[model samples]
Target: MPAFAIAAEDPATPDIAALIGQHLAEMHACSPACKVHAMPAARLAQTDVTFYAARVDGALAAVGALKALDATAGEIKSMRAADEWRGTGAGPAILAHILREARARGYRWVGLETGRHPVFGPAQRLYAAHGFRECAPFAGYVSDDFSLCMGLPLA
Candidate 1:
């Protein structure tokens, strides 16, 4: 397995931009237009969000972000593993990094919204493996048929 190095980066950079564009495209394709909530590169670069990129041998492997929702909570956003790196450790590595960062920042909980469609099964399992449990809508989100929200409380 290739080793992944996860680090904070600007999502608007050339390579990262292309990856995020692909991520957005896939999200839109698999979910209804109204249910697709993947953020564009510009939004991922917002002051309240910290974006990260995972690389293997200096090549981009995946991307993920943590957005501050409040003084004690955060939301995971824009998690996408490059097609070539899927099934590798890229996804989990980047996820662990985000969780670690959340803890270091003293967050009480981290939540994420993902599609409830079968296409998102793997992602749902990934989050579950990391101790995320099904939860109600958070951070202004409302209960919806197309969205599944999960949360992991930091102890």
Candidate 2:
């Protein structure tokens, strides 16, 4: 297994920005234009969002972000594992980090909007393994055939 570490990161950094570009491209490829909710690097840098990066053996491997919806809820966004690290635990590491941050902030629950296509199967399974369940959309998201909304309650 690859050794990995996840930490808060500046989304606008060149390497991070490049990865986000790839993430956005993939989201667009699999979902309709209006249903692609992945945020751009500039948006991830906003104060309400906390972006994270995972590095495996000292090389960037994945990225994820948490956006505060309110004091009681947070939204997970922009999760992506580099092609080379997709099954190397990099995605899980960043996801765990984001959840820890949510708990530390006293959030009651966390949720996310993901695509409903076969290409998103792995991501859906990842969320499920971490205890997320399908739920009504949150934080201004609308119910749609192309979107899968999931949530996990924090104690």
Ten-residue stretch with the least lDDT total in model 1: 138-147
Any residue pairs clashing in model 2, and if so which?
A: none
Q: How far is candidate 1 from the true structure (C-alpha RMSD, Å)?
A: 0.9
Q: What local distance difference test score does each model get? A: 0.93, 0.92
Candidate 2 at residue 40, lDDT?
A: 99
TM-score result, candidate 2: 0.97
lDDT of 2 by residue, 1-155 (tens): 67777888899988889999999999899888999999999999999999999986678899999999999999999999989888888888889999999999999999999988999999999999999999998877886878989999999
Model 1, residue 31: distance off in Å is 1.5
Candidate 2 to native Cα RMSD, angstroms: 0.9
Best by lDDT: 1
Candidate 1 per-residue lDDT over residues 1-155, each given as its tens digit: 67888899999989899999998888888888888888999999999999999998889999999999999999999999989999998999999999999999999999999998888899999999999999989877765778899999998
Q: Please list the residue runs of candidate 2 whose C-alpha ends up more than 4 Å from where it truly belongs after superposition.
A: none
